[model samples]
Target: MTEAALTISHLSIHDRSGAALVDDVSLSVPRGGVLTLIGETGSGKSLIAQAVFGLLPAGLSVSGTITIGGHESIPASEPKRLAALWREQIMLIPQEPSAALDPTMRVKRQMALAGLQEEAIKPALAAFDLPGSTADAYPFTLSGGMAQRVLVASALGVGAPIIVADEPTKGLDSDRVTQAIAALKRLSAAGRSLLVITHDRRLAEELPGELAIIRNGRVVEHGPSAGLLSAPQSDYARTWLAADPRHWPRCHRCCDMTSLALSAHGLSFGWPKGGMLFEDLDLHLPKGGVLAISGPSGSGKSTLGDILLGLRRPMAGSVEWGGLDIVAMPSAIPPLRQRYQKLHQDPITAFVPHLTFARQFLALEDVKSGLSAARDLPPLLERLKVNHRLMNRRPCEVSGGEAQRLALARILLLDPVAIVADEPTSRLDPVVQRETMQLLRATVDQQGLGLVLISHDQPLLAAIADEHLALGPRA
Candidate 1:
């Protein structure tokens, strides 16, 4: 048997308020083997990863011996050696993939941060089937999935023995998930240990080897993958098992039975020198239905949403809303669009930090130009589960989930025929994610509004969207 690369004995961590986030927990990882950490939100799976890398937040206390490399144990406390050790011995793959990547830096700069060569990134990019130019593009320019893959490549470039994979598949489509899992397996085959942490049960099942279930900061169960998955002991494990994607299959069952509420024919869009982000692409969203556009990062899903929302005029083709072409309609006629609201990829950037939700939603007029916006705001906020108290708080004062809810509420007040949401659930917790998607799907359905959900989350999309149009490399 291979030697254990990392071992945690009686590890415990607590936050500023003296609340224990990661209770006394122990785990052992053999070198080059795959051990997945499975749990739900606030389960402290990420706390374990953060503690390993000396990334605990302010006022947080940690105690434990982190054994690495031939019994030379380091208590996460030794700042100097631990910092150096962090850069070399144990590397971290962060929870937020986008944050790990710099919007300003090119891939070369990121490679340099991890003491790697820019030229060698090609193989890493290729492992995820990314184009050769992937290493040359900026993070903002890359699609969500591409940006995610780049971060993984950067981690691999660092060449650490143990990798703490934290929800690495977030903002990725199913095909990319396949690529990521296969790549991790290849790394394991190359004698590198992997600790895959996720709430995605299907992902845990795909990983070969043992599985450890963590709940409320402690390991509730640990054993062989199949043994744990087939018949979990703890209620938490059973809950996670129930959430597994294996129970849900049959791609796009919602598509066939639903009618197209909103659609585009011969839809093509482009810029000065680049190829069309969307070219002759056709799609549809049934009334009160979702149409998921799943694609690799940067494949024009956002552009397509903008095109459909009449935000960006396409170079060619037209978008039909209900019965009329929203894009080609004569602007001479007043009240340009009947129903459309857009929530962009970055809600934080889109929000006015100083403005309260009530004030923001209050800005919507019966008519954007001259006519009053047709709908009222109170029930819209209620439907999204945004509290009346939360309405008074500024965008910055609220959580990401709350801000997104208000963003949706603001759109809801517009009383549009469709809601074009880009990465709506990307950064939210799974439970919050499901709730948000469910709320939006329900709202759109009841209001007769079409939902054009542009996302990389397959399982979430599967539940809400009637049909999916695959784009980018996988398409």
Candidate 2:
């Protein structure tokens, strides 16, 4: 076996209140090799990566020995020493850009903090296919995929010998995924070690690596990448592998061609800088039909959503919903919302942070039926598999999966004639992804609602969408 580049022994992390989030887990990545740590949501995979980098949250207890190269082992308690080695010897590609990036700072300024000069930033951004001007944009102004690429570029900028990428492929499109995989492979070829923590099996299969399946904060399976991934010995591994979109069977639900639920005619949009995204674009979604829109990062998919929802004024075009032009009648939203709703990609951010899930649901129900909807909520929440007790907790307390389901439940309560979901499952685990898609398919069919699924998840779109509208480059 190759000599170890990064190794962790008996690592454990606990919350301030004494709850153990990560158990005694141990793993190693050989020099120039990659090891993917796979796990379901909340399985503590990212937490382990944080522990390795000595970036755990305040008041969390950590016990471990992290050794880099043949250097002396470093304990988690020595923050200064670990900080010294952080960028030069080891680096982290965080899962959520919101966490790693400073919202107040411009993207370029943030990269500068990592010791990247303007000259360095140009090449790095270009390498990731990001525009040079993107450096001046704030984190919130950038798309999720754009933010993700910024993080990747910063990690590469640091020239670390060892990289821990947590869900590095999240929010990326197919072309972007290919580029990221190629970049990581090149790094490995150049003798750098990588610890990739993800729930994406396809990405894992493509990267040069071994498999380390983590569950409940422990390493449950560790073996050769090809063999273990192709024929996983453990049930968790097998189930996870099967959840890949490639393995999913065709969805049986067919498209209904008779009635039109939504129509966009003569649509045209252009960036302020220059160039049009799409012009005279025509699209339609029949009642109870699924229209999946897909394309590369920065491609106008989400922009189209905003236009369709009347949130953005298109250069030219009218979105007709039930023969009414919502774009022209901004005052009609109150009643029109009953037949139109949106489930944003980051549902938690869309939710009222201070309000409990129950209160949020109740408030919407009250808007619909005074107080009668309260009697109907329990059964609906049960059908969605949402715990009643969780309703009392705020959005921040729920898992990503839970928050997504809750968002869906809220939309269902609204009884909309159609719903536009933008990358709804981008942040979920494979298991949750499957479950969420299945629920969406069933809900669309049963409720006879129009569904516009906007995502870069091609396999998922292929399996679920009745008709896919390709956006971007072609746009």
lDDT of every model, 2 decimals:
0.71, 0.81
Flag regions of model 1 displaced more than 4 Å.
Answer: 1-3, 13-17, 59-65, 70-81, 245-266, 271-274, 282-287, 296-298, 309-313, 317-417, 423-437, 456-463, 472-475
**Each candidate's clash count:** 13, 0
lDDT by residue (1-475, candidate 2, tens digit) is 6889998888888755566668888899998899988877666787788777777756568888888866788886666777778877888888778767899999999998886877899898988898888898889867788889998888777777899898888889988888788778877888889999887767888887788988777889998888888888889888887888877888856666668778889999987773688889889888888999998877788888888777788899888887887777767656777778888877778789888787787787557765444687788778766667668678765556567778888888777788889888876778768877888888888878888999998899988899989886622
Error of 1 at 345 (Å): 5.5
State which candidate has the highest lDDT: 2
Looking at model 2, residue 459 earns an lDDT score of 91
RMSD of 1: 5.6
Worst 10 residues of 1 by lDDT: 248-257
Model 2: per-residue Cα lDDT at residue 19: 63
